[model samples]
Target: MPELGGPTSAPALLRPHDPAPPLLDAARLGVAAHRGLDVEALLTWTTDTADLLPLPGTGSTAALWSALASVAAADVGAARVLEPHLDALAVLAQAPTPVDLGAVGAGGSSTWGVFAAEGPGVRLEAHEVDGGWRLTGTKPWCSLAGTLSHALVTAWVSDDERRLFAVGLRADDVLPAAGPWVSRGLAQVVSAPVTFDDAPAVPVGPPGWYLRRPGFAWGGIGVAACWWGGAVGLARALWDALGAREADQLALAHLGAVDVALTAARACLVEAADQVDAGIDGKPSAVLARRVRTVVAGAVEEVQRRCAHALGPGPLTADEAFARRVADLGVYVRQHHAERDEAALGRDLLAAGVAPW
Candidate 1:
């Protein structure tokens, strides 16, 4: 396992005498203001060394563990480093039968994101064109838009139909919005709105295929794995803070609470991974994904709250690593969509009116 603040040159647990891992590469990431992460290195390590992408199911539980470990490491390592790759993995998951996973695995050289943030804000539209397809309009919340070479994007194909398109971000007429992102938390991630002018694209799947796929649900739950790992990182910090040193009963109690929360979250994540690997046909996968995401999100919040209460402002303010973990987790978990997702899941379950066990 890679040590928190970037991997140690040598294994620290086995050889305590070994030098500590190098501190995160600040220069590669960026300076103080709006830090840009050195995502390439992180992606490279995950691809070549960890070999975590294209998540070949059944025989590949290693990918799940590796994904969780990397996310936790990212929380300690770069804070905003894992999102793009996660997006890419989700893309690879739903890719068409003819699509090549070989090129995509090594295409860590070419960073990717799932640019599907559509709303009153910025909605991309796809049109059938002379050769392949063309996408127009704008995509918001495009993480690493300026840097991502490829993206699995969603665009409106018709009033009632939306399709997924595999696009080259560097293609002509696509523009990354500037000056909109203004947050220190997950600031290493460069998310911005983008404008497109009929950029050429290749359709990944047919209309409505993106949201209809089991991978869509799996991707939703996979996010919870990262959140679970992040909470574990915070819980470990609490453990380290207590150590053998004397602490008040309240602090110890809070640590206990954090421990329980993280343990439960991990179990849910593992079970969800198994279901995802085994493939539950139809809405059962979606149901499990929603249930697990909801459970893990709540656990993450509990861990965050308990850690803050027990540890106080010192770690959140003074300790750079702990602060980043807390901050990034806060922002990243917003992918949960709070009540909106809950309402949708609840309404769907109500409509179905029976548990699919």
Candidate 2:
């Protein structure tokens, strides 16, 4: 991960001994960012390096999150595309009967997205068809569905159950909705609803296993790591501006505050990664994930506000790259669910009475 200041720079997110640190190239990502949302180039890059990202809970989870943060620091939009593809690979790898990437996509360059978000009145159902399964109806929140080769989708398998299935996005019947996505941030990512008209599918795990798996919680933490990285990018902008000229007292104060927030967020992530590798104290993974995400999200919010205030209107108005980074981070950090997630964590903590001091 990138640092903010001299000597007292933020702690390295990846350990010095981690072998996977060299696989991520900031220069390559910076070049890719100049392409402006070319899905093919980005997806191809993701495919080539998909296996290099460390799987969560595999004892090298810090390296995984660190790599994610590195990608976001280079370009949040690129991270937007890369994280899910890496996540989809991890999900398949953790499946009870793991699916083979080669079997799913030709030439080993398949890009995948996870389509698990559900919306009101939107129903995607899986049914037994000719000794196999098929999906029907619409699956909302299918990001990059139009461009990806495959996706791990969650759909209703019965009246009361939903299971995850790996489906080819290029299947004839799969329809990725167009338009209605007008967000300035993440303009490169097209997160529209995808309708499956009897699309063929293969189940990744048994009913409810997707959520029950430990990796599910770890995946959520990985996303928080990316949020932390995005915040780091904003902090770097402020740091660079301050170094360019004689800075005022107020701007210096903002930089100090940003450092404090990022320090706490990084510590939370490091501790959570350690716990995940140690089997999470035999507790539900959600507890650990929620705690880390809440802390990181709060830190990200603070960094955004402080960077904006310190930099004033200059970066947002004149610097295109800085403007996009701010916008992309703004949209990406919302994955944390704000107060709703906080409420859920509080209820769980109260119910468990763990006395986490």
Candidate 3:
């Protein structure tokens, strides 16, 4: 596994460490700040590596997904901090081979982590500006606000065409608003609401670019990897903590179970990545993507819950890693696709009387 902050020849930024842990208390606000900075650095590193971009004929999507999953599992706030990079990823996929990770990171890494398009609380809109584009709206769940450099936001072009854009975090372009993301769980994400009063933006590609491509499916797989990583991390933490305790048997059993679950999830991720690389487009790939998401989500939840119980309450309360893993798992598992949608896909496959393999 790649170390979080190892030295590299890439033009990415590096985060310095702080003595305090972000979640300790109000006095540890500095820790949160430091964490946010670290997250930005990590995002830069990710965006700098062309391997992180999905390319034609490159069977590397699974690897990238796994890496992103590890980061999200370790720190969801950091994952959020990298949202702009994710957007730039979509653009990178359309660009030439040997992708310019530095350009992608520099273009969008900052604002992407702080912008949102889902849920009823956030609204985003964009219009063509002189040379770039103008974004006007508010986004809820803007994670890593104080740290992110730009946001890749989605907005309507005349209320019909949905376009994606990269917007810089200029003082004149964005307005900060109070947010409701104060849950004790996933608190490190620090998602807040952002209001855009005619914010300036830059169009990434043609209209309906994101929704019309396989990039969305690929993005979903990346997120699934993150949740899977979190689950694996939680399981590892629990197993290590209780390996020598009286509940050793239970811990062993849980560890075995978690390993199986994670392995299965990884298999699915690899398969999905292969299919994507092979240009297996449309509903079949979409169905497989959904299945991957569902399986990963279920496996991670099971691992987190069981591992937490196996470790007992003492470790849960005192171990920052364990506690954060649990909280991160809780927040990530909710991104599961609707059961009915997944089941409908299964039903269609079954009715076809053909092996989906």
Candidate 4:
């Protein structure tokens, strides 16, 4: 909602409907459902509201990020589930081969997730059969594997090359394994391994294209937007609590610190979205994504720490939503890859010979 560009700039296109309403309303409705770890309710909400979200880098990039952030603010777990689905759609949209979006759950009848993570001793290999691809072996970190009807997954074409493919989860050969997920945060959304036994797939993009695409970096930054939103939610809780009582200087100072961290992170996100639309700087998108993710991740950590220090044990112990939020965000932001990402960014900059201001 804040200025995505300069003072004189207007939104390239007006978002058809505000992304916050459906997510916030779902958050309120899902509070009770969360206790039961109701996965269906979340899926229903995702399918019903999927159309409201816009594709990233499509001039209205800020709106898309705003929607992702709103979802995180409302419910981190919901954001966890929904973000990948949206990312998958965007991935398909960006693919060189034209895809029938409706075939991949864009019709509001099904849900989707992205399963691209590869693990040690496990590989999902894609073999060309009858001029088509069939994914075999296991894929790790397939979130919502049991519930989602489709996924945009990555499988190795050769020893070192991997390509993205769209596969239907409802197919007879797709097997979603049970157990191994026991985190308190995102308790409802289980991310376990899934094995594909000669499962038919449609290649979304050519080998090496998935990670090389600019949208890959944009998707990573979009996750950071969720981190920013999660921080916002925590900061809001701290503010509300402080307002109810005469707060001491320490508590108020923590709030101030929170505001500072969030503002800077938000500014970075806005600028990144603007760059994406305005034809991003000559620098690689990986560089931009790393910078934004690092900033937002720091903000998330700061806000969580400040909120805890300012409010003490009261909210963590008595406020269910607050406690769940804290836990969910703690788990969710780990996607940033912390020190390794920072180091990669440093290495990239050094190689590029970019001067740091």
Write candidate 2's Cα lDDT for 1-357 as tens digits: 347642123335766666555546655555445644777788877776666767777888888888778777767887788889888878887888855444435235677889889899999999988878889999888888999988999999989889998888887799999757998999879899999999888888999988888788888888998889888878888888999989989988998899899999899998898888987632467888999999999999999999989988998999998999999999999998999999999998898877788
TM-score of each: 0.82, 0.94, 0.75, 0.89
Best by TM-score: 2
List of clashing residue pairs for candidate 1:
none
List the lowest-lDDT window of 10 residues for candidate 1: 6-15
Q: After superposition, how far is residue 159 of candidate 2 from its true place, in Å?
A: 1.6
Candidate 2 lowest-lDDT run of ten? 1-10
User: Per-residue CA lDDT of candidate 3, range 28-120, in tens?
Assistant: 222322363365455455454333344422555554564455455445555444434664555545632342224333443333442435668
lDDT of 1 by residue, 1-357 (tens): 223233211211212332222222333223211222455555454344224343524434335444444445345334344544555565665566555433323354655678777767667899987656888999888877786677888899888788887777775688887647786667767688888898877777678877887677776676676677677777777777887479899987997787677677667766666666787646877777788888889988998999889888989879987887787788888888788878878877887888655
lDDT over C-alpha atoms for residue 208 of model 1: 82
lDDT score of residue 277 within candidate 3:
73
Instruction: Rank candidates, TM-score, best first.
Output: 2, 4, 1, 3
Q: TM-score winner between 1 and 2, please give it.
A: 2
| Residue 133 in model 2: lDDT | 83
Local accuracy by lDDT, each model? 0.65, 0.82, 0.58, 0.79
